[model samples]
Target: MSIRRAAIWSFASQYASFVIQFATSVIISRYYLLPADVGLFSIALAAAMVVAIFQDMGISRFVTGQPEMREEHLRDYAAVAVGLGWGIAALVAAGAVPLARFYGEAGLAKVMLIIAGSYALFPFSIVPSAMLTRALDFRRLFQANAGSALAGAVVAIATAANGAGPAALAWGMVAATLARLILVMAAYPVLPRRPASLEIVKPMLGFGGSSFVISLSGAVGMRCQDLIVGRMLGVSATGLFTRASALAGQLTTLMVGAINSVFYPAFAKKRDAGEDLAAPYLHLIACNTGITWAAAIGLALAAEPVVHLLYGPNWADVAPLLRWTALAELFFVAMPLQMDVPILLGRIKPLVWINLLDTFITVVILVVASFWGLEAAAIGRILTGAIWLAIYASYIPRLVGIRYSALGTAYLKSAAVALAAGAPLALSRWMSGAGAEMGFISLLGLSLAGVFCWLVALPLVRHPFWQELRLALSHMAKLRTTQA
Candidate 1:
């Protein structure tokens, strides 16, 4: 499949999954679930996810990224992957009760055990999914992910309606994982059956060992945002923070995350071809920042109305948190693919330290800020992001063989694109005054106008995203004409 086709498949899958998940969230939050319920589950899920990082073992990247792999290599990798997957499942299961007890919530244990069930099924999906991604066969990927989301959403709503409480969310994860596993295995049933030898496993472990540190900071650190808030504030506070951060994350994920899944292998291919990665890297930065920044800025400006619309008034506190987190997203995407770029460039050792420092800075900020209030923690996020960008400033360009000047120019154009995109909504908010309530129809209309302005401004600013967007449109038009 072509990159564009693969990306389209990815977006279709992501949006479908997001819609299901989003609808489920709205339903549960509005009617069924309480803030404390989500907070309890959020803490439990975060722990499982952090422990689940061990399953990475660099297996997917190893499989997808390598330019060459012998049959023996594949078999050894598969064997190692299976062993790691099962090990992580066991680890999560073992830690479940202890973690729950530590949190003083018995429900956390139940939620975690169900989460453990999902990880047990993860081994079955990992290799197959990676193989499909490497082949750019996103059709099967779409089937797996979309099916998983639908299954999960059904289970969540059904269980929540029946009063499963926090465990409902846990069951949703198990159902989702099972659905994904079935589809992925159906697509690629044959796995290398041979056992991995000591020498063969050595490199995988070494790479994974290094990778674990980066994942530790990036994945766990992000999740710890909730954990910290839950411990310091309360379950309700955690729920609000999780909702806010999740919203910010979901926006970026919905917009850019799907295509990013394709880029790992894409970048690997370019690397193997001995291409200078700077231009593609900058194009990626330009494209992603243009989309993510605008969406985030719009989210920030319209946080109150959006929170009211999707989550209802009970989640009103989430609005202010969302505002800061959304702007923090600007700095987060300022240096796109921080870990991935470093991983691809073989700068693992240095990346580890950078990530550690990144974690330290973020945690300290949150801890100190939490004393004031939820709003303080949220504001601290923006500072963390600014520091994040500064730490990455000197490293990324050098790794990608790009100069600072070129990076600055790309960022400038993307900033212009974001400002133009958000102009209408920002203007509307300003005119209506800070205390004004924006009705759904008005908010919707302004958002659409902002989108139109964004598109128009992209070409005006001579953005790389504009060229790519125009080309994509042209391609679609031609395809339609040919079919007709």
Candidate 2:
């Protein structure tokens, strides 16, 4: 299947997921749970997931990265996943009480124990999902993910209403994982019966080992924030931070997550075809930075009213943290395929170091910043982001065989487009004072103005993003015309 078709299916899946997860979260946050309630769950969930990284152990990349995935190899991968997934679930179940005691929250133990249930289903889902991805069969992914999202949402809302507190969120995850396992199994009904041979597992150890390290480090960086923040600033502060980041991250995820799922395999496919990866990589950066940067800025600018409108006055404090978190997303998207391109080029050794550095910087900076206060912890993200871009910029281009000058040129054009897109909103915010003063409706209007300016500026700036927009619009128009 074409990347375009796969992306469409992937986006449909993600779009449905975002809507379900977003709606459930809003309901829970506004009506059901307090920030401390969320924080309690967040800390436990973070710990469990950090260990749960072993469930995959790079199996998805290993599957997708393979040039010719024989049935025997699939069996091998599935065996490894089962052992690790089950082992990790046992570990999480065992540690729940200890971790909760360490955090001094009995509720943490309950949440972690509930979350442990999902990992039992993890191995069943992982290989099938990877197989679907390897085939670019995102249509199946859509079915599985959408069903999973709906199941999770319904469970979360129902449980929260029944006074399950934060455990409701954990139950929702368990439901989502089980639903995905069932759906993905139906979509691709095949699995290894038992463990693969020692020889089979030995060969995979090299790739899986590096991937495990990279994944472990990346997970630590991503999920450890809740742990670090909760320990230092207290659960309420962690709750506020988590709440702010959930919204900011959700918005960014809705934009980039679909592309992310598609791109690793897409890049591998291109590399196997002996295509020059540099151009596609640059084009990806162009498109990503153009859209994501603008949206992140808009979210930052509209954070106040967005918080007020979405979660009510209770979450008004999410505004400032949202602004910083949204801006931090720009750094992430600015360097597209930071992991995939390097892994594709057989540069996992350097990628591993980069990932370690990435995690180190993330933990150190956030820990120090948390000492000051919650918002300071967020501002610390901008510093970590800048450093992150610098860290990856040094090596990713070299792996992709792109010159720094060409990469810099792409950055400049994308930055220009982002600035053009953001200028209207920035000016409006400047004139209108805080987002609350402008109100949600006016803030939305300001955002529309930004979109209009973005459309108008694209062609004037002669950026490649203009052509991408035109192509997408033309494709949609053609589809409509055909239907008509």
Candidate 3:
């Protein structure tokens, strides 16, 4: 399948999953749970995510990016994945109490214990999912993900309705994992058998080891805010921050994350074929920034009504934090494949060092900022994100052979388009002087106007993004005609 087709399927799956998951969270937050309840679950999940980084041990990437994958290699990696999954489960189970005690939230221990069960089921799906991705068979992957998300949403909403508190969230995660495992296994039934030899393991470990370190450090940086907020401020503050971050992240995931899932494998395929990556890399950056910058900025502008509509009035405090989080996300979306480019090119060691530096900067800033309040910690995130982007800019040109001028041109054009898109909304807000008091109908109108303006401004910016957009639409039309 073409990259466009693969991305369409991936986006369709993610958007469906997001709708279900987002709705489930809204129901829980608005009617079923308190901020503190959400916070407790968030903290436990963050801790689990840190340990969960090792569950795959980068075996998925290894499978997807390996130039010459074989049946024997798949089985070998699957066996390693199973062992790692079980080990992660054991570690989480053993450490659950200590983690909860550290946060002074007894409920967190229960959430941790419940979520740990999902780790055991993870290995059952990892290799199959990776194989599907390697094949660019996003249709099957979509089925599995959408089915799992639906199942989890049902379980979570039902449990929350029955007053299960934060444990409901954990149980929902377990259900999702099990559902995905079953679905993917049915889609591609290739179970791991006994390894034929230990020789295959060495190369995988060499690649996966560095990948693991990068992932581990990255996870620590991402989740350290939850830990700090939960420990220093309280569960309420953590809950607010979690809600804001989730809202901001949901936009990026909807806009950029799906495309990125396809990009790594696509880049890997290109690299394997000895193709020039510079042009494609620059185009990818332009496309990513054009779409995500518009979305992120729009979200920031409409944070008030969006938060109120989705999360209810009790979550009003999350709006300002959401705006800041969206700013941070802008930097993130600017270079969606910064790390992946290096990894795909076999420059893993530098990527690891960069991630470590990112983690150090992130942790120090977050820790110091937490002393002031949650907002400060959030601003600290934006600071770290900007610094990390600068670091990526300095290295990416050398790695990919794309000049800084080309990258700057892409970013500037995208930023201009974003500013153009947001102008209508800004003018409307200023003229009305309604600010956060704007009703849903008015806010929705401004958002629609912003999108319309963005489409109009696309070609005017003279960015390659408009051509890519046209190509994507053309592909969609062709696909529909073929189906017809």
Taking the tens digit of each residue's C-alpha lDDT, what string does model 2 give over 100-123? 889899898889888989888878
| Pairs of residues clashing in candidate 2 | none
In terms of lDDT, the poorest run of 10 residues in model 1 is: 188-197
Off by over 4 Å in 3: 479-484
The positional error of residue 34 in candidate 1, measured at the CA in angstroms, is 1.2
Q: Per-residue lDDT tens digits of candidate 3, residues 16-56?
A: 99999998999899999888999999999999989889998
- Per-residue lDDT of candidate 1, residues 1-484 (tens digit): 8888898898898899898999999999998888899999999888888887888767787777767755456666776677777888888889988988887888888888888888888776777888898899998999999999999999999999999998999999989999998898899764656554678767667888888888878876788888899899999999899999989989989988887887878888889999888888888888889889989999999999899888887888899999999999999887778888888888889999999999999999999999999999999999999999999987888878888988889889989989998999888877876422678889888899999989988988898988888888999999999999
Q: Which prediction has the highest lDDT against the true structure? A: 3
Instruction: Write the number of the candidate with greater lDDT, choosing between 1 and 3.
Output: 3
Cα lDDT listed for each candidate: 0.86, 0.86, 0.88
Scored by lDDT, model 3 comes in at 0.88
